[model samples]
Each structure stands twice: as C-alpha cells, then as structure tokens.
Target: MKMDYEQNAKIFKALSDSSRLKIIDILSCGEKCACDILEYFDFTQPTLSHHMKVLSDCGLVEVRKEGLWNYYSLDINNCNKLTLFMMNLVTETKDCICKNKSNCTCK
Candidate 1:
C-alpha cells in the first residue's frame, strides 16, 4: 500500500520529542491512565496532556475517557504501518549511481 507522506510526517514529528517518545515507551507495555502516565515524568499535567494530544492526533496513540481520567494505548495498527513504511523506504529497489561510484550494492 502507498503511504501518505503528509500523515506519516505528522507521526514522525510527534515522535521527535523525547518526552513523547518516553510516553510511547510507557504505553508499549499496555494501556495506561493519564495519571499513571504522568507519574513517569516531572512535567505538569497540562504539558503531558499536550503531548498526548499530539500523539493521538498523529494516530500513534488512542485515548479513552472514563469519568475524570483518560486512558491511553499505542495504536498498534498505525505503528505497524509506520514500521512498514520505514522498512519499505530502505528495502525498496532503486537504481543509484553510487553503486558504481563507491562500490555500493544499492543498484
């Protein structure tokens, strides 16, 4: 399947932050409450909420509201799509002059 560069760029941009990456790492184990996720960092609740917004907006995470708390989990399908996109980028066949210029095998 063809990848949407614009949407994928959003995912990459969202993952660029260290805090956000950490959030992803936290979610990797399982779904977590917003309060539980906040415990791993020193940032304020608002800051964490902002990070969650970026992640969910990019389709990298999913959120559910229960009473006063929010639950979050990694969107595995989207994450798999991202993995495939990256793999395709490197694995796809392409002809390049570097094959002859530098004795590379990318021909």
Candidate 2:
C-alpha cells in the first residue's frame, strides 16, 4: 500500500505528547477502563478524554463504551504497521523516497 504521509504525520504528532505515549504504554498491557488509566496520572477526566480522542483519531488506539465509561486498547495492526513504516523509513528499500536521487548516500 502506498503510504499516506499526512496520516502518518498525524499519528506521529499524536504520539509526540508524553502523556499520550504513557497512555499507549498503559494500554499495551490490556484494555482498561478510563478510570483505571487515570489512576496512573494526576489529570482530570476531560483531559484524559482529550488525550484519548487524539490517540483514537490517529488510529493508534481503539475505544469501546460501556455505559458511561470508555475502555481503551492499542490497535495492534496499526501499531505494527507504524513499526514497519519506521523500519522501512530508515532502511534503503527499493521504494525508498531517495531511490531516484543521485545524492542519496545510503549504502
């Protein structure tokens, strides 16, 4: 599949926040209710919601609503794709963006 630079950029931007990175780490263990996640930090519910929304929007997180609480977990497929993307990005693959550049010094 062709890479969507904008989408990847958004995903990276969402991950740029330390809180969101920690949130990902928390969810890595398993899906957890919002309250359980909040226990790790001193933020308010609304702030957590905002962070979750950012994560969710980037396709890095998946959420489910049970009654009034939101449960969150990592989107494993997308996370794997992101990892592959980073790997490909740093390697000199045939599809590398610099393949056509004469100045590319990648060996």
Candidate 3:
C-alpha cells in the first residue's frame, strides 16, 4: 500500500511536542475524561484543550462528549497504521522508497 506522506508527516509533527507525547501515553491505557487527564499535568485547562485539539486534528486521538464532559482515547487504527508505516520506512522492505531508485547503491 502507498503511504500518505503528507498525512504521515502531519501526524509526526503532532507527536513532536513532549506534552502531546505524554498525553498520548496517558490515553494508551484506556479512554479518560478530560478532568482525569488534567490531574496528571500542571498546565491550564485551555492549554490541555489546545493539545487535545492538535492530537484530534492529526487523527491520533478520539474524543466524545457526554453531558458537559469530554473523554479522549487513542484512535487505535490510525496508531497502528503509523507503526506499520514506520516499520516499512526503517526496514529494507519491499516497499522501501529506495527500491524504486535505479541508481541506489545499497542493493
């Protein structure tokens, strides 16, 4: 399968921040309410909201609302896709980009 390079890059950019990385790690266990997530960080609610928005925009996070509360979780499918893409990118696999280059010296 062909990789969406632009989308993958965007996803990578989303994970560039330490705060967002920690947020992703936190959501790995299971879905969490916004309040519960805030307990682990010293940032303001608006800051956390900004982080969540970035994660959600990148498709790495899933969010739902009930009443006045918002719950967030990892979007497992997209996360798995990223893992597979990274593996393909690093390994000398059949899909390696260099394979298509006729002048590639590392056969």
lDDT of 2: 0.92
C-alpha lDDT of all candidate models, in order: 0.89, 0.92, 0.93
Best by lDDT: 3
**Candidate 2: where is the Cα deviation over 4 Å?**
101-107
Give the Å error, residue 57, model 2.
0.4
Candidate 3 local lDDT, 1-107, one digit each (tens): 67789999999999999999999999999999999999999999999999999999999999999999999999999999999888877777776777789987655
Q: Each candidate's TM vs. the true structure? A: 0.85, 0.91, 0.94
How would you order the candidates by TM-score, starting with the best?
A: 3, 2, 1
Query: How would you encode candidate 1's per-residue C-alpha lDDT over 1-107 as one tens digit per residue?
Result: 57577998889999999999999999999999999999999999999999999999999999999999999999999999999888766674443334445667564
TM-score of 1: 0.85
Better of 1 and 2 by TM-score: 2
What total of clashing residue pairs does each candidate reach?
Answer: 0, 0, 0
Question: What residue pairs are clashing in model 1?
Answer: none
- Residue 70 of model 1: what lDDT? 96
Model 2 Cα RMSD, 1 decimal: 1.6
